[model samples]
Target chain A: MNRMSSENNLDKPKEDEIVRIDFAFRKELAEKVEGNLASFCYQCGACVGDCPATFYSDDFNPREIMLKVLYGLEKELIGEDSVLWLCTNCYNCTERCPQDVKPVEVIISLKNMLADRGIVPKTVSRIIDTFEKTGRTVQLSSAVTKERAKLGLKPLEEIPMDEIHKLLAPAEEDSGK
Target chain B: MNKFAFFPGCMIPARYPHMEYAIRKTLPNLGIELEDLPEASCCPDPIYFKSKDKLSWLSIAARNLCLAEDKGLDIVTNCSGCTATLSEARHLLEDEELRTKVNKRLARIDREYKGEVRVRHIVTVVRDVAGYEAVKESVKCKLEGLKVAIHYGCHLLKPSKIMNVDDPNDPKVMEALITALGATPVRHRNWFLCCGKACQDEDIPANMMRDILSTVRDVEADILCLICPTCFSQFDHGQVRVGKRFGEDFNTPPVYYFQLLALAQGIQYENLGFNRQRIKPKILDKIETTLSHA
Candidate 1:
C-alpha cells in the first residue's frame, strides 16, 4: 500500500506547500502558558471526539489548532475573526488528550494573545468593561435587588471598586506609580 | 454544622436569584451554614475574562478567595464557573513563581493568596462534606417516582487535575445526589455532553443543546437536574430557542439540584420561584397534587 497515493493523502504536502514556523509567536505563547502544553500534542484526535464545537462546526478543531500551534501559526489563530472564540472552554479536550496537551489552555493563551492586541469581540469587551467598572460582570440593577428581597435573600453588597481598579491597572501604570 | 463562605458568582445572584434562594433555604437544613462573602466580584467568568487577561482573572478570583480567607472559612460556590476559576487559580498559584506573581497584583488590594482555604462546588459540599445520607434524612417530601436526567455541565468536573470533583468522564456525583432525593437518576444518551452554554456561535450551542435535550426527552425524565446555573439557563430558557431553531418540542424543564433539594426538604413550591421559570417543571405540579391528597 503506497500511503502517499491514497485519497486521504493530505498529510503529505505538495512540493510548493510550505508551513513557516513562527518561533517568536511560539515563544510568546510559551511565556503565557506554563510548560508550553501545546508542544506535547501528538495529533491524536481524542480532543475532537468529545468537542461540541468540532461536532457542529467545520472550521473548529482542537487537534488542528494544536497542529497550528506547533507550526506557530499565530496569525491564523489570534485575529479578530479567528475561530478560537468558537471554543466553549469545556476542557473536554484537556480531559481526552492522551499527551496531556491541555489544548483548551493553549487555545485560551491564544485568546489572551488576541485580547492583548485589542481584537476582543464586542460581547467579551462589554463583560470586561463591566467587570472593570462594577467589579462584577452583571450589573446589580434595582430590579435584581427587588427580586432578591422577594426571595428572602440578603440584599446584594457592593464590591470594592477602588481595590478592583488597582488590580485592573495596566502594567505601565503600575510601573509608573 | 459546617460553615462555608458562600460565593454565588454573578449569574445565580444577578440572573437566577431563585437558585440562590433555594441554596440559602436548603443547605442550613443539611448541616451546612452559609456565610455571605462581602465584596466578592465575579469569579470574573472563567472564559472571556481569562481570555482577556489571565493575570487579572487570577487576581480577581484570588481576591474573592481572600474574602473567604479573611473569614477563616472554606468557600462553597453555587456556579460551576466560580468553582473552576477559584479551584484552578488555587491549583496554579501552588507554583511559587505564579503565586508570587499573583501576590504582586493582590498586594495592590491589600490581599494575598496564602492558599489557606479550599474552594468547593456546592454539589461537592452537599455530597462529600454533608453526605448523601444527610440529604436522604433531611427530605420531608421525597421526590419519589420522579425520573431525573442529570446534566453535570463542564466545569463542575473536568480538567481532572484542577477541579478534581469527580471523574470527568464517568461522574456519579450528580446522579448520587439525585437518587438521595428519592428520585431515580436516569442515564440518558449524551449524559456526558456539555450543555454548550459557553460556546459563542449560535449554531454550535444550539446543536449541542439540542443533542442533550433530545436525549433527556428520550429518557422521559420528569426534569433535567443540574448543578450549574448556566446549564439551567440553557435547558430552561435556551431550550425554547433551540427547539424553535431545530423545529422540535424540547419541553423538558430544567431544575437546579438545590431547587429539587429545597422542594424535597419541604420548602413551599411557590416560594422557590418556579413560576418565573421559562419552562415550568410539570413534576412540581404532580408533587403538589400528591401533597394535597396526603
Candidate 2:
C-alpha cells in the first residue's frame, strides 16, 4: 500500500502511482476514527469460520473482504463480481470479531465507495431506483394494495414523482462539491 | 413540556397512520408537543446507503435538520432509520472538514445545517420526558397475561453511541415500556436480528419473507412490538408471504409499541389500525378483544 501524505488534496498521487487512501476518509465517512483493527486480523479465518452465508455460498467471506481492504487492495476489494451484496449487515462479524475490526462497517464503507463509482450490482440498483422513484421501497403489487384496503388500511400512497425528484435535487446538487 | 419538531418520515403518515395517530393522541397527555415539519420527504435510507454517497446522505438529513432548526425546535422522529440518519448526519456536520464538504453540496438547495437541533427517537422522548412512572400513570389498562416480544430494530440500537437509547446488547427501554403496560415482555433469541432490510437489495420478496419467518420462529413470541417502519412492514407483510411459502401454519404476532400503548389508552383496535395488519385473522381477533377490554 502506498503511504498517503497527511494532506487534504485529492490529487496527491503521481500519474502512474495508486492513490494512498488515508484513515481520515474512513473516519469522516464512518463518523469514527478507523482503529485499523483490520491490521490485527491474522487470517485465522475465525470470522469466515462461523459465517452462515460462507457455508452456503463461497462468494460471501467477511474475512477475505476485510483483509483485502486492510491491504489497500481497493481494486480487488470493490471490483469483484461477488455476492458481497448478500451480507445482511447482520453484525455477526462485529460481534464475533476477535480484533474488533468491525468488518460490518468496513464492508458498508467499501460498498458505499463502490456505489459512488456507479458499480452497484443490478438488483441493488433496482431497489435504489424504486426508492428514488417512490418514497417507499415496498411496492405492494396492486393486488396486495387491494388486500390491504380490504383489511381497512389505506393504499400505500404513490409518493409524487416530482416530490421525490425535488427531495433528490439537493443531494444531486451536493455531489458536484 | 418539551417542544420537538416532529419528522414522521413517510411511513408513519402513509402506511402506519396509527403510529402517528397514537403519538399525536398520547404525547400531549405526557406534556410533550410534537409539531410536524411540512414537506419532509423519505429519509432516502435505501439510496444513500446503497449508493455509498455519504455526503449526499448527510446533506439530505442535514437539510431536514435545518428545516426543524428553522422552526426553532429539536427534531424527534418516529422511525428509527430516520433518527439514525439524522443523528449521524448531525455528528458528521459537527466536524469542520465534513461540514464544509457536506454544506457545499447542501448550499445548492439554500439549506445550511448548523447542528443546533437535537434529533431523538420517539422512544427516547418517552423514556426521557415522561419517565416510567409517568408512563405507568398514563396507562389506563394493564396488559397482564399478554406475552409480548420487543423488537429493537437495527438502526436504533446499532451504532450505539449515536443512538444512546440503551445498552445495544440488552435494551430495557422497550421492554420496560411493555412491562409498564402490564404485559410480560419475554426475552427471545435473535431479538436483535436485522429485519433483513439490507438483504432485500438482492431478492425483493423472497429474502424479506425468509428473514421474517426465521426470526419470528426463532423468537416464537405471541406478539412482536416494533420501533421502526421497515421492521413493521417486514414482519406484517412478510408473515403473510411466509405462511404461503411453507404451507405450514405460521402465525407469528406483530404490533407497534404505540399500538399497545393505544390499547392501554383504551383506544379501539380499528382506530389503532389493527384491521390494517396482514397477520392471521386469529391473531387480529385476539388483539381486538385485548384492546376492547382494555
Candidate 3:
C-alpha cells in the first residue's frame, strides 16, 4: 500500500516489474470526477456478480476495472484490455456496490481519459466524430425518409453541426485541462 | 395528456420507423398526443457519447431537455437509452457546479438548463400518465392467450438513483403494460438480465443476448415485449445473427410494446409491419381469435 516514488515514470518502469502506477491520474479521477469511490473499492467481486456481461467474458469484471483505477493501471486497462467497451454501462454493478463504488461512472471517466489520448477503439472513435459531423450516430437516408413518410412521420431533423461544434469547444478545452 | 414532444432517439427512426408510427397511431387513441422534439441530437447516445466526453454528453443532453423546457412540456422518449441518458443528465445537472459548467456551454447557443421539464419514457407516459386502467379499458379485445416475456432493457431501470424510470429488479411497469394488452407477461429466470445493447463488440453482446433469448425460450414465451429500440432489434434481428454465429436457435420474436398497444386499440394488422419482423409476430392472429370469441 506504500506509494513508491520510482514507479512514477511512464514507459518501462525503473523497477524490474511494471507496477503500472500513475498516481496523478488516479488522484484526478478520484477527486475530480468519479469521486473517491474507486479508492474505496475492496474488490469484493460484487460488481462481477452484478454484471450481466460477465457471462460472455470472464475478464469483464467491473471490480477489476475499479482495481485498475485504484492501482492506476491505465495502460493495462485502457491500452491492453478492451474491457471498457465490454461494459454495457448497465449500472447494476454501481447500483449494487456496498461501498458505493460506482464502477460505471468510474468506467466513463476511464473512457474519457482514454478518449482524451485518442486511444479508444476505432468504432467508438468514429461514432464520437460521427456525432460531431451529423449530430446523429446514424444518418437518415432518402429510403428511411420515404419509410418515415409511409409511417406518417416527419423527417427526423438533427442539430446543426455548427451548434454541436460550438457546444463541444469548451469541453474539448476542458478535457485538455 | 394530449400534448407532449417525442424523443425518438436514433434507433427507432433509423431502423424502426414503424414503431414510432405505431406509438403515434396508438397513444392518441389513449389520449396522448406527441409533437416533434425539435433540434434534438443523439440523447447523444447514452453509452458511446457519454463514455467519450462526460461533460459534453451532459451539456448536450441538458440542451435537448431545454427544448422541451422552452415548450413547457415533459419530454417522452421512445427509446429506453434516450430516457436513461436524459434522465441521468437531468439528475446530474441538479448539482450547482455541474449546472454552471453545462450552462456556460449552453449559453453560446442561447440555451440554459433550468431543469424545468421532465423526461418520461413512453412506457411511463402510458402506465403512469395515461394510467394502466385507461389503456386496459381501451383494449376491447384480448390477445387470445398470446404469452409475452417482458424484457425491460437496462437503461429503463438502472442506476435507479439517477434513472427513476423503474425499480431495477422489481420493475412492474412493462409487465403492467403487457398485462393491459390481455397477454400474459411470463415471468422467467434471468428476468433481470440485460440484452447487452451497450456492448459494441458484436461477440460479447451476441453471447449475452443469446443467454437472454434462451431464457425467453425456456419460459416458452410467444414473443418479447420490448420498449427500447436497441433491445427490440437485438431480440428480433441480433438474435438471428447471434444464433447463426453460435449455432443456437434464438427464434423468439420481439414485438415493440407500442405495436401491441396499437394493434389492441384496433390498428389494422397489415399496416403495422409484422412481416418485417424476423420471427413473424402473430399478435394479429391472437386478436383475430379474440374478436371471433367476442
* Number of the top-ranking candidate, with TM-score as the measure: 1
State the TM-score of candidate 1 restricted to chain B. 0.97
Better TM-score candidate (1, 3):
1
Considering DockQ, which of the candidate structures 2 and 3 is the better prediction for this target? 3
Query: Quality of candidate 1's docking, in CAPRI categories?
Result: medium
By TM-score, highest first, what's the ranking? Answer: 1, 3, 2
Per-prediction TM-score, chain B alone: 0.97, 0.90, 0.94
TM per model?
0.94, 0.77, 0.91
Cα error, candidate 3, residue B226 (Å): 0.8
Give lDDT per model, in order: 0.86, 0.68, 0.80
Residue-wise C-alpha lDDT for candidate 3, range B190-220, written one tens digit per residue:
6788888677677788777877888889999
Error of model 2, residue B41, in angstroms: 2.2
- Candidate 1 CA-lDDT value: 0.86
Residue pairs with colliding backbones in model 3 are none
lDDT (10s digit) by residue, model 2, range A1-177: 334454564455566676565555444334322324566677767778645456445577888877665556666666647456667654557656767676766666667667756788776777567666665444446555554564454445444455345435544333333
Q: Which parts of model 3 are misplaced by more than 4 Å?
A: A1-21, A28-36, A171-177, B283-294
Candidate 3, residues A1-177, lDDT tens digits: the string is 234555764354356566667888787665444445687788898888878777678767787778778888766676634678788877888778998878888888877777767777777778777788888887677877888887777777657777777888755435445
Q: What is the lDDT of residue A11 in candidate 1?
A: 71
